[model samples]
Target: MTTLFHNLAAWVVAWAHTPYASVALALLAFAESSFFPIPPDVLLISLALIQPRHSFAYAIVCTAFSVLGGMVGYAIGRYGGRPLLERFMSSAKIHAVESYYRRYDVWAVGLAGFTPIPYKVFTISAGTFLLDFKRFILASFVGRGGRFFLVAALFYFFGEPIADFVNKSLNMLSVAFAALLVGGFALIHRLSKRYGQGSARPHSERIREP
Candidate 1:
């Protein structure tokens, strides 16, 4: 697994110099949403560091393709069902994902998207569990967009001086960013409750675990 990850990282980095770098990024974003193991950030971060001015553009491409790819993942779950999901992920893992859906509903997608969690798991599980399609898309859009844009913004604004820091601390940066997002969400939920705006989510949204 480590060897394959290193090889894939190298392959993704090599594309940064080519004319098709953005295309590769888009493809990586797409594939990773479903089947690919490596995240598009490997390429996004590489390309952005080399060409900071185009960071947001790269982020837009990554987000768009990732959401499109997520739809395909949803289709996989909708059509392929539990049997197909079992082939890619273990039953225990699948059940855990389903449990998240039961608890957080569509927001589970947002959490998975913004964090280091394997998005493919939530994407496929969203389908197998028959989550609302529109909500799934919305959550994916926000979560994926937030993450890619946040990564891009750093290199885009800070330039070369921060390159080493970003490279060394990217994982920690992502974790901190995700924690902030989660905190913001919790705060909003709390505010809504305090203001009496916290209406109960529809029961259907909380699909029971299979």
Candidate 2:
């Protein structure tokens, strides 16, 4: 599994040298938000290193499609994920996440989107927990945009040194960031089960329980 991801990462990185890298970056951003593991940062960083002048454009493409993909992940959780989680996961535990979501919906999604905490899980779980869709989308835009554009900015100003620094330390930094949050993704392990109950409905129609 480790080797497979390494190969996949290499393959994604290779696309940066191609004329199709822009397309690959867009596709990669969209995929990573939902199903793919290796984040678009790999491609975004590589592309920026190749042509720092175009870095901002690549960031725009990355942020936009990633949010779109997050919406799809939300649907997957809303319609499918909650049912699967219920078979083995405890209601008491999932309800803990429900309460968490009810209280910190945007912060949860936003932080997940920015950090290495697997935003896909939170995106799907947001639907499973019946979080407000508009807020989810807004937070996705902010967090994903912030992450990708920060990469763009680094290369734009810092030039070559940032290329090596960001490439090597991005994961370490993300881990450090995650460490600051008490429980972080651990708090989300018990994340999704509510939609199986009375929570499944149009995102716009859903309301918090009193």
Candidate 3:
């Protein structure tokens, strides 16, 4: 699996050298947000490195398509629910996301989108939970846009050094981001337990319980 991802990343990097990289980047971004395993960052960074002047354009394409793909995930969750997600994801992963959705709602989706945490989980969970469509779109735009643009900006300004460093340390960076996600979720859960107890329970639970 590791070797396969590395090969795919290499292929994406080579593709970035071509003129069609722009379209490829958009499509990868779209797919990543919905069901693709590889994130668009691999391609986005490679393309940005090759054409620093077009870094921002690449970021824009990534952000726009990512948001669009998120909507597809959301639609699947809304209309198809767990059966659809189960086709691609494990039951445990889906359950974890459901728990998070019950606790954090929009913030969960936004943070997942912004971080290395798989944003598809939250996008689909938001739909399954019937979260407000407008709120979901807003969160997706803000989080996905910030993350992709940040990567583009770093490549634009720091150039090859950052690119080389990121390429070499990508695994370490993902681990660090994952750590942060775990910590953030722990804190959110603790705070909700302590301070949100007084609030009324979620509607679905309330209906189901009584």
Candidate 4:
């Protein structure tokens, strides 16, 4: 898998200079938001690094396609994914996902869109939970757009230095970002549990002995 990824990354890097770069970026962004294991950020950053002038445009394209792909993932979950989830994912994983979604809903989707949290899981969960499409699109747009644009903006302003820093420290950054993502989801889960359950609970002053 590592070898395949390295080769694929090399291919994408080579294609960055081609006119097909934009098309490739869109496809990659789309796939990444759905079931593809690789993140589109690699292609976006490589292209931006090679052609700094068009970085923001590249970011916009990446964001748009990514959100669209997320919608597709949502549809999958909403339409015919629940049974598959039960068949494929572990009980523990399902409980974690349900708890998080039951707690956060759209905010959970947004954070997953931006962070390093295997976005495909949240995309599918959003559908299973019957979340609103409009709100899903809006949250995905904000989160994914902010993430790609932030990277593009940094490359636009800092250029090679930023690239060098990322190349050298990517593993560390990935770990840090994952930690933050998990913590954010946990907080959202807590808040959702508190409010959702509180409203559902009845006020009682009398206790009967069993």
Candidate No. with top lDDT = 1
Backbone clash count for every predicted candidate, in the order shown: 0, 0, 0, 0
User: Judged by lDDT against the true structure, how good is candidate 1?
Assistant: 0.89
Query: Each prediction's Cα lDDT score?
Result: 0.89, 0.81, 0.81, 0.81
Candidate 2 Cα misplacement greater than 4 A, ranges = 85-100, 172-210
Tens-place lDDT digits, model 1, residues 90-200: 878988898888988998898789888988888988999999999999999988998899878998999788778877887777678777877898899899897664346
lDDT of 4: 0.81
Which runs in model 1 stand beyond 4 Å of their true positions?
A: 197-210
Q: For candidate 4, lDDT tens digit of each residue in 1-210?
A: 899988877876777778899999999899877777778888888988987888999999999999989988888888876886666568798789888777767877876777777777888778888888899889899778867887788789988779978666644665565467669778998999999887776556234456
Give me the overall lDDT of model 3. Answer: 0.81
Counting only residues 3 or more apart in sequence or on different chains, how many pairs clash (N, Cα, C under 3 Å) in candidate 1?
Answer: 0
Error of 3 at 177 (Å): 8.7
lDDT of 2 by residue, 29-146 (tens): 8888778999999899988888888899999999999999999888877888687546534778568556768776666787777777777767877888778899999989977887
Candidate 4 wrong stretches, greater than 4 Å: 86-88, 168-210
Clash count for candidate 2 is 0
lDDT of 3 by residue, 1-210 (tens): 999988887887787878788989888889888788788988988887888888999999999999999999899889987777788678898888778778767766776877778777778778888999999999888778777777777788888778888667654655565457669778988999877774666767647753
